[model samples]
Target: MAVGQVGGLLPHVAVPSTMPAFLIPEWGLSYGEAGLMASAYAIGYMLAAPVLTTLTDRIDARRILIFGSLLNALGTVGFGLLAEGMVSAMLLWGLTGLGFAGAYMPGLKALTDRLAPGDSSRSVTVYTGAFSFGVGLSFLACQLIADAFGWRWAFILTGLPPLIMTFVAWSLTPVTPAPRAGPLLDLAPALRNRTALGYSFAYGCHCFELYGVRTWLVAFWGFVAASGGAPLGAVVVSALFTALAMPASILGNELALKLGRHRAITLVMLLSAAVALAIGFTAGLSPWLTLMLMLVYAFTVPGDSGALTSGMAAAADPRFRGASMAVHSTVGFAFTAAGGWVIGVALDMAGGVSQPGAWALAYSVMAMGAALGPVFLWWSRRSGASS
Candidate 1:
């Protein structure tokens, strides 16, 4: 299933990967406009995740997973062939995000539902770790393919993998959840559960920072190279920055198990925020220093992911687990949608993406978002009185 997800995500960053080098030049897009196109995927997912994830409470998630995978393939391939400009690109990319709304959390629910009853904490953590791995591979693969075969084939070739995930979904043992006790869409219960809400909110803040950095990291690297920094493949650096998250997240989860989820997560977020500020104010002065800080930024940003998901899962009522995840993902992706676009707007306001000051301001924006995470986590514990 993890392998399938890896494949499903092959096209995850195809646009951003190609945007700096190809799509922006080809389509004559401004930074804000390009960011909007990048954000369309998260917006689509935010729109659809609630419905699809909520359905898993009373149905087999395998069905939704298969459907999402198909939609993902359609949207991705369609973009390769049919996307001629901004509007079409946003619509198609949004469709792909809609597809992921079905694939991601539903797939996780499917996996956990089929597991033997016990602590699935590590299992959940590892699954999210796979998400980072898949995204990292997307950055690497999409950029490489675009360089070799043009941007069209990058989307086209990457789009094919989700079809493989569709088949994987078909083979999963069917496991329909017991009939849920309330209205399918009643998220009020989830809202009232402050413990889960806290983790969800923190996850939202996390996504805001993580996706903002990711959406613009390649472009930032390009700016660095152009500004007399070391000449490097921006995409490769972006890939490495993201790929490091997998192990970092796993290790972070393990640390949480020992230090306590809240404590460990707070520490990581605080540290990450500090790094974000450092990167903003100082790192760009030297290419090697920037690379080091970026690698550290990667570790710190996703370090809380597994712990947050596990905390939310444990906090949610069993009967409404699906709905809980729905709320979690919806909030998270809403921030994800905003992250890229907000950073892009910041870039424009700060004197465009080419300037070192613009990059500094952008990273400062990421720091501001991350700094809010621990507050949410603390509020959850204080208000809910949950351990």
Candidate 2:
């Protein structure tokens, strides 16, 4: 499961970190256009999540995962060959997102369906945590491949991993029987359930902040370098930050389990938002200090990640796990799909990369998601969440 997820993220991040540099000169794209391409994956994810993930309740998720992998591989290859403008980039990356929707939640559904009761929280935390490392490799891979050959080969090579993962997962993982639960795709139970809704809503905020940071971190690093101090480069810094975040996800989940989920998420989200609010202005600070701050910020941002999913999983109706996940994914990824373009628009409005205020405003907008998290938690508590 972990390995397949790692493979899944490869195609997703293959372009975002490098696309602006590679395509801007060649395609004459603006920052907003570039940001749209970054958001395209999430757009595709939001579009496909409800149906694809819900179908796992009635069908083998492994089968869906294979189909998704095939779509991602094809999309990656298509991008390598066909991406020339913003439209093409968004369409192709959107396809990548659609493919991802299959692998992610369906894969989770598969794992949870098989696990014994009480075992899923720890298992789910590990699985969710793997996404960070997977993306770290995606950034590192894009950097190395682009340096060695060209930008296109990064997609071409990363694209193959999903195809390979499909076969490997098919052969190795247990074939979970499809759920006999009637109204397999109905989401009413989850929607009407406050505990489930709380986790799902919190996940939306998490994705809003998480994907926004990830999509723009590399470019933001470059802007920082140009503004004042240089810290290695965007690619290296992004990869390092994501790599460190892998451990933080698991640690955060365990901490939340010990500290109580509601308190942990509220504390972590507010603290992370505070750091995010401050981080944009630190570009002109000492390079080492800025880098350290970034590392800490990265840790804090993903700190609630595993906790959110595990919380939702714990709160979900057993018969409607797939449907609950569908709702969770749809709500979460909707903001993720919009995050990049919103930041770009904010950046342009604030006077592009030249003005420190632009970056600050844009990052603050992203941090708003985190800031809203505590509010949701409060509402959930007030509303009488079951979990």
Using TM-score, give the best candidate's number.
1
Cα lDDT tens digits for candidate 2, 180-258: 7566567788788788788888888988888888877877777777765675888789898887777988999998989
Per-candidate TM vs. native?
0.98, 0.96
lDDT of prediction 2? 0.83
Q: After TM-score superposition, what is the CA distance of residue 111 in candidate 2 from its true location, in Å? A: 1.0
Please identify model 1 stretches exceeding 4 Å from their true place: 229-231
**Model 2: what TM-score?**
0.96
lDDT digits (tens) for residues 257-319 of candidate 1? 999998999999999999998988874588878878888888999999999998898889888
- Indicate the worst ten consecutive residues by lDDT in candidate 1: 224-233
Model 2 regions more than 4 Å off: 172-184
